[model samples]
Target: MIRNEIKIKSEEGELFDKKQIALAIRNSTFEDDLKCSLLEDGILDKCQGCSLKYICNGIDQVVDSYMEKTTEIVNNFNFD
Candidate 1:
């Protein structure tokens, strides 16, 4: 459902505009989906008996951090 009219090139030889990229990213599914998939696949359980869980903010916090960083990137990315 993406519109084909969104096209802009940057000064450094970029072929797409930041706004267009942002819109495409905004419409994509991510963040929670990845978290759920990783959790369900037992990836988060790797920290169940880790000694550095507290120091590393635990697996849940790590996943939350990933989601936060993804959101930040999708919100602040630029073609430049």
Candidate 2:
């Protein structure tokens, strides 16, 4: 499954910071319990006030449970 998407509070073409979002993800115990589908669900739970808007921009993709392991976001990209 590919979580190759981004989320944001607005669509004003904001260039958010990835390090901050990464840090939040790392610090979030609940985030650790989240599935690998980072960009698929409502990240507001994880990225509440985050700055990594670009990472989830133009994101309308999804990866259901049937998602494969050799997919894009899970296999190719490493948000960690």
Candidate 3:
């Protein structure tokens, strides 16, 4: 995944290395599992009409705009 030196502090005030966190995240299937559960429960269907459907964590207008602009630019490109 992404590499960084960010340290995480636990509730017990103990600091841990970012490598441990990265390893845990890299080995986790939490996002796929959550998406599957939400789809089974019909939660994902509800998000179909939402404007922020592309965003998983939260609403980011900048990313949405960038995606739209990128798509438009790509569509206008002459690949032939």
| Number of the predicted model whose TM-score against the real structure is largest | 1
Best by lDDT: 1
Q: Tell me the TM-score of each prediction against the true structure.
A: 0.24, 0.22, 0.23
Runs in model 1 lying further than 4 Å from the true structure: 1-4, 9-15, 30-80
Query: Tens-digit lDDT track for model 3 on 6-55?
Result: 56667977577856544444334333222335656776766666565676
Order of quality (lDDT): 1, 3, 2
TM-score of 2: 0.22
lDDT digits (tens) for residues 1-80 of candidate 2: 53323443357775556655554444343234334254456545664455665444312121221123223563565588
CA lDDT of each candidate? 0.53, 0.42, 0.50
Model 2: lowest-lDDT 10 consecutive positions: 58-67
Error of 3 at 19 (Å): 8.6
**Candidate 1: tens digits of C-alpha lDDT, residues 1-80:** 65554675568764766666444444444532223344568767665775665744554464565457775533655697
List ranges where model 2 is wrong by over 4 Å. 1-13, 30-80
